[model samples]
Target: MITFFRSFFNSKIGVALSLIFVALIAVAFAASDVTGGASFGGVGSESVAQIGGEDIGTGEFSTTASNAFDQIRRQNPQLDMAAFDAQGGIDDVLEQMIGSYATATFAESIGLGASKRLVDSEIAGIQAFKGADGRFDETLFRNALAQQGLTEARVREDIRRGLLTDQLIIPATFGAKLSQQLALPYASLILEGREGQIAFVPSAAFAPKGNPTDAQLQKFFADNGARYRIPERRVLRFATFVTDRFRDQVKVSDAEIAALYKKRSAEFAATEKRDVEQLIVPTEAAAKAIAAKINGGASMAAAAKEAGLEPVDLGLQSRQDLAKSASVAVANAVFATAAGKVATPARSPLGWHVVRVDSVSSIAGRSLDQVRNVLENEIAQEKLRQTVSDFTADLEDRIADGASLADIAKDEKLELQVSPELLANGQAPGKPDFAPIGAYQAMLPIAFGLEEDSGPQLVEVQQGKEFAVFEVQEIKRAAPPPLASIRERVATDWALAQGLASARKLADGIAKSSRTPAALEKAVSGASVPLPGIEQIRTSRQTIMQQQGRVPPPVALLFSMAEGTTKVLEGPNRTGWFVVHLTKINRGDASKVPELMVATRQQLGQVTADEYGQQLMAAMKAEVKVQRNAAALQRVKDQLTGRNREN
Candidate 1:
C-alpha cells in the first residue's frame, strides 16, 4: 500500500520581487495574492479567470500558460509539463492573469490611463523588436510574436495593463528609503550563527544482499517506473550553405560601377567636419557664465563641474548635421569659432547652450575616377547579396513544391549532416560525452517542433547569410525504457530503495530516542552495517547565506531546527537520511559591523520600496473582485496535460 506524510518546511524565504512587475506576476503567480473574489454566474462559463468586469477567456489563459511553460523549459531543458504543473506552474499563470486584470480594473476606477502613444513607445523600446541594425523592425517584431504564439492585440493589452499597474504602484513606493535604525534588527538576524552536528545513514550500508527474484524486480520497476523515464530526443538531418557558396559566381560590370558612382556623387563630395564640447544650462546667463570662465582660461570641464553640469562631446559632424542635432544658431556659432576657443552662448529648446570648437578638418572634393575602385567594390558586394537572395528564394520554391532535403542536397552537391538524437537543449542522453555541432544547435527548436511526417523546411541558420534545409528524422517520446532493457539498473536501484525505506525509519527512531549529539552519534555508529563517520559543524546562518543556493539541504535544515533538538532529514534522490543535532545557537551583534549595516540598509531599502508597492497593489486588488470558472479552468489544465485535449 502507498503511504504519505505531511511536511512542514520553513516558509521564510526571499521576497522574490523584481523591478519588472509584469514579469514578476508571471513568475510568482500567487493565487492567494489576488485580492477580490466573485463567481462566473454573470460572466460566461468560457472564462478561465475573471476580474471585476473583465474576463480572460479560456483560449487566452491556455496560451499564456503554455507560453510560460515554454519559457521555464528554456531554462530547465529536461523539465516536462507534468513536473512543471506539480510545482504550481498552471496556478501561477492563472493568478498572474487575474492579478493583471484586477490591477487594471482598480487603476481604471481611479482615472489612471495607459495611452496609445505610451504603449507605442513601450513596444518600440522592446529590444526583441529591434533588428541587426538596431532599429525597430516590424517584420522581426511580427516573427517574434508568431514564435511565441501571441497576437499583437494581446501583447499591446498586456503592456497596457502593466502600465496601469505601474501607475498605481511606482509613485507610492518610489520615495521609500530604509533608515539604518529600521534595518538594525534584520541585520542582526542575518549575522546569527548556529553550532550543529550531522550524522549520515548511508542506504548502501543497509542495502539488500544478493539479487531479487524476477517477480520482485518487476514489481519494483512497475512501482517506480517514472524514476527511469527517458526524456524526448530527436535526430535532425540537414545540409547548410553559406553566402560564400554563390560569391564567386556573382558579376558586376563597369557600367553598374559607374552608375553607382553617379548615384553617390553627393556622398563623395568635399565637406568640413568639426568636433565640439557643449554644456547646456537652464538659463542663458548660466551658459554665458561658463563661456566667460572658459574665455578667462578656466577649462570648460572645470567651469561646468563647479556649476553642477557636464559638457558633452559632439563627435565629428558636418555643419548641416550639427544644425539639425542642436540648433541653427548654436551650430553656426560653433563652426565660426576658432579651434580650441569658446563660442558665444545660444539658446535651444532643451536650455541655453555654451559651445567650444575643439577641432575642425576640411576635405577636398573627389572625382568619379578617384573613387572608382571603392564604388566598384560596393556594387559587386550588393550584386553578390542579390544573387544569394534570389538563389535562396528559388530553393524555397523547390521546397514548397515537394522537394526533399535529400534531393536538394544532391542537386547542390552539398554534404548532408545528421545529428545524434538530442534533447531540446541539444544534449544527447545516451551519449553523455557527446557535444552538438554549433550549426545544428540553432536548428534544434524548429526540428523538435516539426510534425513527425512533415516535409523539409529551409530555415535561416545565420540571419541573412547561412541557410539550412532540415527535417526531423527520428523521435523518441519521453517514457520508461522496457523492464528487460534496464533490468540490472533497476535491480541496483531496488536494493538502494529497500535500504532507504528502512534507513528512514531507523534515522527517525534515532532522532526521537536521542537528545544529545554524543548520544545521536553513538546510535548511528551502532548500526547493523558499518557507516561513514558523523560530521560535526559549527557555523553561522550568515555563512550559509554567503554560500547562496549551494548550501546543502542538511546544513540548511540544521539552522532551522530548534537548539538542543535532534531531527532526521532525507538526502538527495533518496540516497540516504541524515540525523541532525543542534548543539548551540550563537547570535552575533550586528550593531558594530559597518559593512553589514550598509548591506542591510541597501537590501532593506529595496524591500521597503517593494513593500510599499505591495501594499498599494494589495489595496487595488481588494477593490477589484476576482472570480474563476472551475469547469473551464479544468478543461484548460486537461488540455495542458493531454487529457481530453482540445483540437
Candidate 2:
C-alpha cells in the first residue's frame, strides 16, 4: 500500500488530485458569503450544471467560482479583476467546478464515501488548526474557519468528497510500467550521431542588385504597415513626493543617537566564539579514555589517531551554532572549558564526544563613536519616512477634494513634471530621454488602465522612498506612420527581404544541381558570390538540440536525410540558408547509454500513465450524462464580473 501510494502520488493523476484538494480547501472557506444570501434572480432557479441526474445549483456554482477567484487573487496579489478576466480565469474556474461535480457524482454512483471519524482525523491533522503544542485546538480551528468564511459542516463535507475521490482514483492509476522494448528505440534515436558537410549561403552574399524603386518601397511599407504601427501613447502630469528629499532636513541630535545606541546595545555586542575539535567514539568509556590521554601529556591528534578515529574540527562556532549542530550538553561543556584545556566526555545523539577548546574569542561591545554614523543615518531615514507619509497623505486628501496635481504641486513647492509622448512600454520615440516621475515600470500599467475622467491616482513608485499622484493629460491612439516619414526604415527592410529571397533561390539551385558532397563543394568553390566558410563536422542529435550556439539548419536536416542526400535548410532569423549533405549516419547502442535510457524510460512511463488517466476520465465522463444551462452560467459569470447585481 505504501509503494502504491508513492507511485500514484508521483503520477499525473496524483498531481490532478493534489490540485483538486487545494481547490476544495480554498472553496471550503470562501463559499460562505457566496452561498449565504446571494441570488442570480431568474437564473437562480435554474441549474448551472447536471451530472448523472444530480443538479449543481446556481448558488453552488457561484460559490465555487468566487472561491477559485479568491484563491487566484491570494496566489497573485498584484492581479486585478480586469487582468484575471482577460486571462479567461472565470471560464477556467467554471470548467474546474464542473469537472469536480462530475467526478463527485461518479464517486457517489460507485458507493464511495468517507467515515465521520476519517473526516475528523483529516481536519485535526491540518497544521493551520493546530496550537503551538502541535495538538488541534478548538478555538484556533474555529477562528481559522471563520476567517475563511467557512462553516465546519461544509468543510467536513468537502473533506469527505475529496477522500472518496482519492480512494476511487489512486489505486486504479498506481504503478504503471513501460517495457524495455517500448523505450529502447526512442533512447537509441536520441543517442544517434550524424556526420555531415555543411555550407552556408549568407543573405549578404546575394545582395539585391541596385536600390529598390520608390514604388516598390512604398508597396512593401503598405503591405506590412501594421508591423510598424506604434501602440497608444499617453502624456501624464505628475507630482512626486520623495523620502530622500526630506532626508537632508532631518536633524539627529547627539542625545538621540546615544539613546538609540543604548536601546539597541545588544546588537552592538559581539557573541563569544570558539574553535573546538572533537573525537567522537561509539562508547562513553572510549571518549573518556581519549580525553584522559589528551589531558595527560599526549597531543589531541595523536590520541585520536591511537583510537583509530580522525578528529573532527568544529571551527569558530558560537553557542547557538554548537547547540544546533551538536547536542546542547556538548555545547555547554565546550563553552565551560578553558582554552588549551580538554573537556570531559559529552554524550550526544551521534555517540560520545571528547572535546578541546583551541582558542576562545571573548565577547566585545562597540563604543558609541564606532556606531554613531550608522545610528544617525537610521534615525534620519526613519524621520524622512514619517515626513513623506504625512506629506503624501495630505496630498492624497487634497486630490480627493478636487485639487488638481498642478495646483497642489505649486502650493507645496514641489516639482511638477510632464512626460513626453510615452508608449505603453514607457519609451518615447528616438533614444529614451524621458524618466518617469516615480517608478516608471510600476506606474505604466496603472497609467494606461486609467480613464480620461478618472482624474488623478496616487501611485507608490518605490516602497519606502517615493510616491506620485499622476493624471493623464492626453492620449494618442496607435496608427502607422506614412512611408515618406519612415522612408529609410522601409528601404532597409525592403533590401533585406529581397536579399533573403535571392539567397533562398541560390541555395535551392545549388541543392538541385548537386547530388553528392563532392559536387556541392565544387559548386561552392567556383561560385561567383562570396559564400560562408564550409565546415565538415560530426555532430550529435543532443548537441544540435541543446548546444548554446546556433546549429546551422543543415545540421538539423542531416539527421532526417539518408546518407549522400543533399538538402537546402532555412537559416535562423533569415540570416541566410544552409546547403547540407548527409555523409554518414551512426546509430548509438542503448545498453551503453544507461543514464539516458533510464531517463527516457521514466519519461515514457509517466506519459503513458497520464494518457491512461486522461482516457479513463474521458470514458467516465461519457458514461455520465452532463447538462449545462448556458444562460444561467453566463448570468453567474456576469455577477462575478460585477456587470449586473440582480438579487
Candidate 3:
C-alpha cells in the first residue's frame, strides 16, 4: 500500500492535482480567516457553478482567481489586467476548480474517502508547517491558517478530497502501455537518411531590364499601400520622482545601527564545524575491526583500502548537517571526538561507520565594526523607500484633486519633458536618435493603455525607486502617407519583386534540363550570370536543419521526391531559388538501432496514456450534471475587470 501510494503521488496527474491543493494550503498560511457575512455557509447563493449537485461558491472562485492572477503577475510583471482577461486566464482557473470539485463528488459517490488519521499524517509531513526544530508545530500551522483567512476544517476537507480523487484517477490513467508493433513505424521514420545535390539561382542574376519608371513606382506603392502604413503613435509629457534622489537626505545614526545589530546578533555568530572522513562497511563487526586497526598502527587510508572501502570526505560540516546526512548517533559520536583523533565505530542506517576528525573551527561572531558600512547602507535604503512611498501617495492625492501635471511639475521643481511621436514599441519615426529615461521601458504599456480623454495618473516606473505622472499630449492615428513621401522605399521594393519573378522563371528552365549532377553543373557554367556549381553532398534531414546557414526549401522537397528525380523550390525571403536532384534514399532498419526504438516506445506510450485519460475524463464529465450561473459569471468578470462599479 505504501509503495502504491508513493507511485501514485509521484505520477504526472498526481503532481498536477496536488498543486491545486498545495496552492490552497499556501493561501491558508498567508491570509486571515474570512469575516462578516462572507463565511462558507453564507455564500451558497453566490454559486457560480454546480457540478454533480456540488455548489462552487463565488468566494472560493474569487479567491482562486485572485491567487492565480497574483502568481502570473509575479512571473510576468508587465502583463496588464486587460491582457490577462483576453487570454482566458479567468476561465482556465474556473475550469480547474470546477473539474476538481466534480471529480471529488464522483469519488464520494463511489464510496472513496480518506480517513482523518491519514489526512493528519499528510499535514504533519508538509515542510511549510514545520517549526525551527524540524517538527510539525501546532502554533505555526494555526498562525498560517489565520494569515490566509482559512479555517482548519476547510483545509482538511480539501486535502481529503484531493487524496480520494487521486485514488480513483491514478490507476485508470497511468497503467496504459503500447505494443512494439505500434511503435516501430515511427522509429523507422525518425532514423531515415537521404543524399542529394543542390544548386542555388540568385535573384541578383536575373536583374530587371532597367530601373522602373516613376509611373510604375507609384502604381506599386498604391497596390501595397497598407504594408507601408504608419502605426498609431503618442506623444507624452511626464515628470519622474526617483528614490535615489533622496538617499543623501536620509540619515542613519550609530545608535540605531547598534540597536539593530543587537536585535539580530545571532545572525553574526557561526556554528562550530569539523572536517571529517567516514568509512562505511556492511557489518558492525567489520566496522569495529577497521576502527581498531586505524587507532593502533594502520593509517586511516590504509585501513579503509584493506576493507575495500573508499573514504568519503564530509567537508566542514556542523552537527546539524551530520545529523541530517547520516544519523544522530553518528553525529553525536563525531562531535565528541577530539581533532586529529579517530572515533569508535557507530551503527547508522547505511550500515556501520568509522570516523576521523581532521580539524575543527570554533564558533566566532563578527564585530559591529566589521559590518558597519553594510548596516548603514541598508538603513539608508529603507528610509529612502519609505520617503518615496509617501511622496508618491501625496502626489496621487494632489492629482485626484484635479491638479494639472504641468502645474505639479512647476510647483515641485521636477523635470518635465515631452517625448517625440513614438509607436507602441517606443520607437520613433525613421529610427531617429533619442534617449528615454531608464524607466520608460517599464512605463510604455501603461502609457499605451491610456485613452486620449483619460486624465493624468501616477505610474510606477521602477519598484520602490521611481514613479511617473504622464498624459498624452498628442495622438497620431495609423494611415498611409502619399506615395511621393516614401518614393525611395517603394522603388526598392518594386525592384526586388521584379527580380524574384525573373529568377523563378530561370530556375524552372534549369530544373527541366538538369537530370543529373553533371548536367546541372554544365547549365550553371553556361548561364548569362556566373553561378555556383552544384555539389553532390550526403546528409540527413536532421543534419541539414542543424547547419548554420538558412535551410533552402529544396532540402524538404528532396526528402519528398523519389530517387533520381529533380525539382525547383523557391527560397526564403525571395533571396534566390534552388534546383534539387534526388540521388539516393535510405530507410531505417529497427534491428540495427536499439536506443531509438526504446525512446519511440516510451513516447508513444505517454501519448496513448494522455489520450486515454482525456477520453475517460470526458465520459465522466458527461455523466455528471453541470449548471453554470451566467449572471454570476458575468458579475465575477466585471469585478475582476473593475467594470461592475461603473455599471
Candidate 4:
C-alpha cells in the first residue's frame, strides 16, 4: 500500500506535471485535505520533522497525510486508518513531505524561485477554485480553502515550493533515448516463451481434524489481537434545507420580466438559420467558371471534387453568425437564395465564394404572453440564487456566533437527522450492505473532515437547490474486539497454521527431488493424501506483462527458471504451495517485428530517465540532511490508532 502511494503521486500529480523520482512523492498543496482538522497527533505536538533548518509542524504534516490517505481510500475503500498505519502509510506520507521540502531547499540554494504571478497562475489552474463559468472565482477559491481548513498563506507557500521543485526536476530528465543495440536484447526477451507443469500441495490436504483447546485459542487470540482491531467509526448528525423554504419570500414581478425581456430583446425575436456548403476559389474567374459548370447541369459536388476541392459544410448558422465568419455580401447572397439552389459568387477576405444553401430553419418570435412560463422560470431562478446566497451566509454567521446544529434546527424550524456510525466510504463496519443515501453521499467527505467540537457547516449538496448543515456527533477509536466474539475463527486459523507447516515440509521434499519431469510425477503420486493433478501452463513473457501483476506464482517462476530446473512456490492467501517444473523454453527474435523493437526502445529509454531522476532526488536529499523526530512521529501513529489520543 505504501509503495503504491509514492508511484501514484509522482505519476499523477508530480512536478511540472512530470514527476519521476520514487524518493520524492509529493502531492503538493493543490490536493486539498477535505477533512477540516489535521490533529493526527495531539493538537500541538513537538515538531514532526526537521529538513535542514526548517521544521515541519505537526498540523502541516498531518494535513498532507490526511490528503494522501483520502486519495488512497478512493482506490481501496476497505482500507481503514488502522490498517493504513499498520501498512506503513504514515512513513510513506512523511517520506513524500521530506522529498518535497528537500527538493525545494536544493532549488532555493541555487537561486531558483517561484514568482507570485506564476504561483497565482498555478492556483487559478486548479479546477477546485473555478466557478460555473469555467474561470477562477475568488468566492469559490476562498470557499474551497476554507472548507479544507487551510490558510491562504500556507496554500500559497506550498504551491510556491511545488513550482520551485518543478523547475529543477524537469531539466534533469529532459531527453533520454536508449540505443537500438541495447534495446534489441530486452525486446527479444519479451517474446520468449516457456511451458511448465505445476503441482499443488494443499495445506487443507494435510489437515488437523480437531479444534484447539480453550487455553491454546486464548494464546492465539492474544498473539494476533491487532488483526481483530476495528477501525474508527464516526456518527454524522445533519439536517437538510431546500430552496423551497425561501421560495415564499421571493416573487418574480411582471415589470421585472418585461425589463429583462427588453434587455435581451434580440433573443426573443424570430430568426432564420441556414445550413450552407461552400467552396472558395482563389480567383474570381475560377469561382465563376465553377459556378457556370453547376449552372450547366453539372453537380456542384462533382464539379468541386473534379477540381480537387471539397465544399465545407457550415452547420446551422444565423445570418449574423455567417457574416462574422464570411463577408456581409456572402451572408446576404446565401440567405437570399432558396434551399437547394446555388448562390452568386461573393468576394471575402479569404477568396471568391461559391455557396449552396442546404437547408433553412426559422424560430417564430414569442411575445410576453407566449413565454410567460419561461420568463417566470428564468426570473425565479435568478431571484432564488440571491435568496439562497443570503440564507447560507446567515447560516454561516450563526455558526460563527456559536449556534449548534440543534440550535439552528429549532430556530429555523428544520428537522435534524442522525446517521449511524460510518467509515470514510460511508459504510458501517458491521453492516456491509449499508449505503449512504441522498445528500449524505456528498456530505460524508465533508462530515468526516470536521472536528467533533466544530459548529455546523452548510454544504451545497444539490449545487443550488439543496444544502445540509452537519457536525460530527461521535468518534469511536479503532481497537480490538472481545476475545469471546472470535474464538471459532481463531481456532480455524490455528488449525490452518498447523496444516500449512506440515504442507511446507512435504512441498520442499518434492521440489528437492524432482530433477526431471518423470521424477516430479512420481513424487506427486507418492503423496500420502489425494492431491490435484498437475496442470500445464504455456505462455510468452509478453502475455504475462500484458496482464500486469496478475500472474500465478508457478507460471511466473517458469520464465525465471532453467529449462530443466524445478522450484517450490507458495500460493497467494496461504491456500497451498506449488512445485513448478520448467519443461521447454522458446526464445524470440524481436528484430523481425520492427513495431515491437521501436516500442521496447522507447520504454527502455523512459526506464533510464526514471533512474536518473531517482539518483538526482537521492543526492538532493543527502545534501539537505533530513531529520526525523522519533517521538513526534510515533505520537502521530499512536494518535491515528487512538493509542495516544490524550497526548
The most accurate candidate by TM-score is 4
TM-score of predicted structure 2: 0.59
Report every candidate's CA lDDT: 0.75, 0.73, 0.73, 0.77
State TM-scores per candidate.
0.67, 0.59, 0.53, 0.74
Model 1 clash pairs?
Answer: none
- In the range 373-445, model 1's lDDT, one tens digit per residue, is 8887888788878898899899989988999989999999989988887888888876889887657767876
Model 4 lDDT per residue over 1-647, tens place:
01111232242233312222221222224323323334544546456778878777776666666666666655665466667777677676777677678888999999999899987887787776778999989998888667666677777777777777777766776688899889999999999999888999998877689878889888877888786777667888888989988888889888988988888789889998898888999998999888888878888789899889988888898889878998999999998989877889998999999988878899899897887888889999888999999989999999999998899999999889888878777888667788788877878777666666877778888888889998888977666767777777777777876788788999999988888888989999998777789897889998999989998778888988999888988886456799999988999999999999999988888777767767777888899998889888877677665566544
Question: For model 1, what is the error of residue 373's alpha carbon versus the real structure, in angstroms, after optimal superposition?
Answer: 15
**Candidate with maximal lDDT:** 4
The digit string of per-residue lDDT tens for model 2 on 200-311 reads 8887666576788988988888888866776557888777776777777788899999999999987788779899998889998888888888889899889988888889
Question: What are the runs in model 2 whose C-alpha is more than 4 Å off?
Answer: 1-173, 199-412, 418-487, 494-513, 522-537, 548-553, 564-566, 573-577, 617-647
Task: Report backbone clashes per prediction.
Answer: 0, 0, 9, 1
Error of 1 at 284 (Å): 29
Q: Looking at model 1, report the run of 10 residues with the lowest lDDT sum.
A: 1-10
* CA shift of 629, model 1, Å: 2.6
Which ranges in model 1 have alpha carbons more than 4 Å from their true place? 1-45, 77-82, 109-156, 171-182, 241-389, 400-402, 413-418, 445-455, 459-467, 608-623, 641-647
What residue pairs are clashing in model 3?
29-144, 30-147, 30-148, 31-147, 31-148, 31-149, 32-147, 32-149, 33-149
